[model samples]
Target: MSVVPRVANDSDPDISHVRDRGALRLIACGSVDDGKSTLIGRLLHEAQGVLDDQLAAITRESRRFGTTGEDVDFALLLDGLEAERQQGITIDVAYRFFSTARRAFVVADTPGHAQYTRNMATGASTSELAILLVDARKGLLEQTRRHAAIVALLGIRDVVLAVNKMDLVGWSPERFGEVTAAFRAFAGPLAFRSVIAIPLSARFGDNVAAASPSTPWYGGPTLLDHLETVADEIDIGRGEVLAPPRARPTVTRRFAADLVWMTDHDGLAGGRFLLKTGTTTVPAVITTIADRLDLGTLGRVPADRLGLNAIGRVHVETAVPVAIDSYAENRSTGAFILIDRTTHATAAAGLVIAWLDAARDVHAEASAVAPATRAFVKSQEPLVVWLTGLPGAGKSTIANLVEQRLVKLGHHTMLLDGDNVRQGLNADLGFDVASRAENVRRVAEVARLMTEAGLIVLVALVSPLRADRERAAGLFPPERFMEVLVEASPATCRTRDPKGLYAKAEAGRIANFTGRDQPYEPPLAPALVLPTDEIGPEIAAERLIQAILGRIRQPTASDDASI
Candidate 1:
């Protein structure tokens, strides 16, 4: 047995040449048994990319599993998984690589099943060209149309129609032409850049690598030949790359009549301008040039510093001037989305229009202290503690204790008990899945508002589902939302029976009660879990407080003594 030496990039000069030229990534897609896997395996084998040992292994595996008197099933080469071998279907997108003398190809053999359309989409999303296969005898099927539609939707510009199983149909030119015309008619209105059709029998390797004598009437280039010669298309709408840079101007406006403007080269140093009109984006260098100038018409400015939402025109002098527009002209194309430097999440959506003058007027009229001053006076950071557990699991008890401790510390605190809130705020909500989700959503919104108002909010709810908990978590800042799961066994909760709700569920009076009929998916990674079997309510409350504050390094002797 001989081994084909692995081709090394450093040793092969042609490999480097192709790398410089760039690789062609093609995704092969078709309905089941259109020979997608077989086509790819044959391409790999005929191109001498497959090693002898691997081929022998595939051959041995084929003989052991091949039905009755079947020839070497080349599909077996790519269908390596046990599940796929048993089912004889490709369940996922299988990637294979092979190269020819001119170019290297990365092939994605996508699954054809309707259920695996998402996987097909995954394969097609990055593909520059989609090789759509069809059985010559079958003509065109619904699945083929579906695959073509998805290819167009995912923005694949180039398409190669591989009409497989020509050998099964006796290499009929008329049959191939009929299928090709039908496909073209179906795909004519689609957004593909180009559609090239070829007739090939992947099983017998006809018209695949080299021109097959099987089709003398067909005069088109071979599949590989067409792939190697096709010109790489470019998107023309992307504007000129080497155009002379425009001079970006920074304008500064005063609350009075005078407006000062500067250019990138020599513009007025940092001043604020009310965006009068036009969509524009000035360079960040303007921030260095101006100090502070106020403009009229905008509403009360809230912050002392010019952060996001503080937009002003300042004079700037770049080496040149660039045409820019005000953010109000176009929101999507003109405005910029600002993200937090640390978290990378969108912190604020900014528009260039500014109302600095109006902001100063509003600030002059308002006599109340600012929110920052109020927060400072409170001497506590506002946060929301969400307690989730089964009913009768002592959530309310723990929440009450925790709130009392915070109250004693002179912190403004509010407890939104699940049962109490249901009476007033969530009165109209029901126990169905959608209703339950809505109820939790309303509570989370109210809690968020309370936290933002500089009040500590403790919510005690039997939020049985994990999805509901995650939704609540997303509404608040990461540092503000704390999830505390009150862990108690179903038997323990039933024995406690604080509300007799468990008894009602068992007696068939109530339906879909958590831990009785409906499921309670426990939190996978809660901030704190209080086990009622071991820790008393007092200790649990202290633990919850310590988790939230992080300043209480060691539990005081009095704290433990009280528990």
Candidate 2:
């Protein structure tokens, strides 16, 4: 092996022709018996990567395992595993490194069995281009569709539709065109960088390494020529191929994944599964299933659960925040495997696409007075009692009573109501969803600040969106934050409209009304649910105060308790 050092300005004019190119990683995959292993073995053999002794051994070995007598089974060079030889199939991803005079290549001959789809994904993560072969005699199969879906998920955009075994079908150009056109239509809007279709026979070595005269009708480059020119443009002056540069990869804390369930058990939402990404492993849950892929039609359909071999777009939440990147950005950081806890079996493989709510860039500043120290000084734990509901859901009525009860109990407390807040800090904001979310965010910030000062804060607002409310709850410790939902039907709220906002909204005098025009998303689960129609604010407020008092009871355990 010789290393060529780059020269910025050289005395020899030939130095200007050098435009640096990196090693290309490729994976060959498609339906089983589509000649994936044969194609790879042929490439390595043509490149002269195999040693003389190894070639002799394989030739003899091929005779024993070869289906065709003394034909030198090219698949034998790749299918070296004992099981693979017995089965006469590539069951694992067989990786090989070879170099042409002009380029270096790393090829992963992935298994085409549908059950081993995850293995194809494993190879595609580090690969940039895929050699997706279809048996010209057999056309496209379910395994071909499955491989395409998985390769797309793993972010391999450059594809080569190798219509292999053309000899078996008499090297028919019509068959090749038919398979190619069908694939293009099936993979419409896939947005891969390039899709080069080439007809070749791995068995006959036609178009595998060089252009073949057998296909006089075919006008495109051979399989090797296309693979070497992946960068698209050749610099005649420099004699180098320049691949398009990619944008910078971003670091994110969250992303949606296309999860492939591999185990027999069904994927359960909210179940704690161990997620392993790169070198980091953490507990995670499939928060929600967005949609699943229907392999038959290649269309997305609504689904809540994934069974064995099922694929779905899902939202995953880790127990702790993770520093991740999109699969398109960095495959190592974006690919992950979910493992079942009881069986300890690999359950599913996931590819991260978009990063949501990333916290990697957020840096927390240290405060001089810690919240614990402030609370200790005041002889009470800090708390944020958040009340959410419709406009006239008796939030303020219950809030006022709760404040009075806490005050009577000698607890220092303050009530921050929606109208009062709008009079000052949020006076400029309107009633839109964005403004409402910002409103809740600001309130949560203020409440967090107040709690840090050892004050019990009561927040009463018609914070409609559950997502906004969840954000507010995230601001404080789980035990210190309480979500109280004041339940009132739209009719009850309109009937008890002391502010008369509902009537005005119904009369077209107002816009963005919570119950009249805009909808409110009530909390699915809350610390307390106050049915104002059944009970008065006083009784509800009393129950809330008791809950708060019990929650704020700090542990009195001492380090010297054993003594």
Candidate 3:
């Protein structure tokens, strides 16, 4: 494949227009089959970014898929990967780049399915605007509202609601007005600073690149026009910028006497100074130095002996008495966080609190654990058994059985069931993609803690989606994480109806419920696949135990194995 280089010509007015213009990173979000890909492809094709070879490829795919109409199947252009082409649904955020006469654009096409909302967040987190697509025929659906709410939460300031499929709806002005009004009413209170609504048909090229004659009643500019004009500036001063540095006291008597030098100019020549600690950047000076009184031997040395990465005690005079302890004291309150002034990204994690000599000794004594004794008496291994399946699949049952077998083997274990966690630890969480991700995040964190404490952790969650499972897997080492896919047909799960959730979802009591209203993306690959419909819980547990034992028996010398 040949790489396309970015070209700019000073003589060309279009190129010159964008010479110094800032880049805009935008996310396109909507329900499945809402023509997000087509709209983006239209924008790219009209802007002359789509190469002849790539356009030919898209045409070939379109013909193969039986889209014989003169208008190209623009969706084929973005469904580039083989898996995405076959699936007919975007499971991941597809990034595409294109430039206009006024500005450059980096577009993130995110999945509209509720199951992949987390993926949408990953795209929108860094976006300046969210282009939310609304199918003109379907109006504003549940997923549309969900995406809007997510865009607001991610701090995106600009939103463009492209009401697409106008050709299918005969480009009705009243329909466009109604849908646009409903969406604006729902999104008005969100964090977005501006919202622009446009009527367009991504497939028919209406209101995308050029003003569509079909929608003569519509007065606003096309989608591309809005994108080209939307301001790309962002305010990043909402959060704290810098954190305080950690401080520690010196144990040497000479350093104690150097306290005077902390504020005095004559005591030390090249000692390091910090303007602020934590949020307070108060100016301080070394004032007093007290010599070591307990030293049995007498020695004279300059205070310059304080070397690189060395800790020392010095009395400091500040413009004000800043409340700060040695970094060795408290890791949280004493810690300082650093942010990059340019990109606004967190650059470094810092510790601010420090401890004095006597306090350091006491802290060391209190916090130190007898590792050798603990290892000898009750050494334990930590592992996470991640169970994933459809909603009513028998994950919890198998998890219970596995816990019993591990307990019988004299291993410390804990079960983190989805329902139990939803009631307690993840009570504040919802069923949306963001909430689901947060739920999994909490579970993964708890599992990590349990593993560190030398306990086996079993997580019985429907998990449903592969991205969530992958995020959980990333939290632990490969050897420590066992992804067990409890396979059962969606039909079987609805039939099982262990908790009547499926019934409630089918009755419309719940909106965007997985397996009914939302999609359940299965695990692409898993360490184990237990046929929940075919096997009993006991047999499943036995199989899992055997697999665990086999893994343990493998020639791995240590548990902290890196993958």
Best by lDDT: 2
For model 1, the stretches where C-alpha displacement exceeds 4 angstroms are 1-21, 41-94, 98-104, 110-122, 140-157, 181-194, 203-206, 209-221, 229-377, 420-429, 445-454, 474-481, 487-511, 524-563
- lDDT for model 1, please: 0.64
Tell me, what's the RMSD of every candidate?
A: 19.6, 12.4, 24.2
Which digits, one per residue and each the tens of the lDDT, describe model 3 over residues 198-251? Answer: 988888788898998887787888888888988766322222333322333222
Where model 2 places Cα greater than 4 Å from the true spot, the runs are 1-21, 232-254, 328-332, 355-563
Model 3 segments beyond 4 Å from truth?
A: 1-21, 66-70, 234-563
Give the alpha carbon lDDT tens digit for every residue of 1-563 in model 1.
21111101111232224344466667888787788888888788878878999888877877776431456667777787788888888887777667778877667788877656545755664456888999999987766776786566445678999999999888998999999999988887775788999999887777778899999988887787877776553211112122222322222211211112211122223221222112222222222222322223122333223432223233222111222224333222222322232344333222334322332223223425543344445655678889999898899999999989988877788999999988998999878555566677779878877765668899999888775677678666777788889999999999999889988988999987889787887898988899987889999999998886772222233422222
lDDT of 3 at 546: 81
lDDT of every model, 2 decimals: 0.64, 0.77, 0.64
Provide TM-scores for the models. Answer: 0.57, 0.62, 0.42
Q: Which residue pairs in model 2 clash with each other?
A: 17-238
Instruction: Report model 1's TM-score to 2 decimal places.
Output: 0.57
Q: Best-fitting candidate, measured by TM-score?
A: 2
- As a whole number from 0 to 100, the lDDT of residue 279 in candidate 2 is 45
Clashes of 3: 35
Global local distance difference test of model 2:
0.77
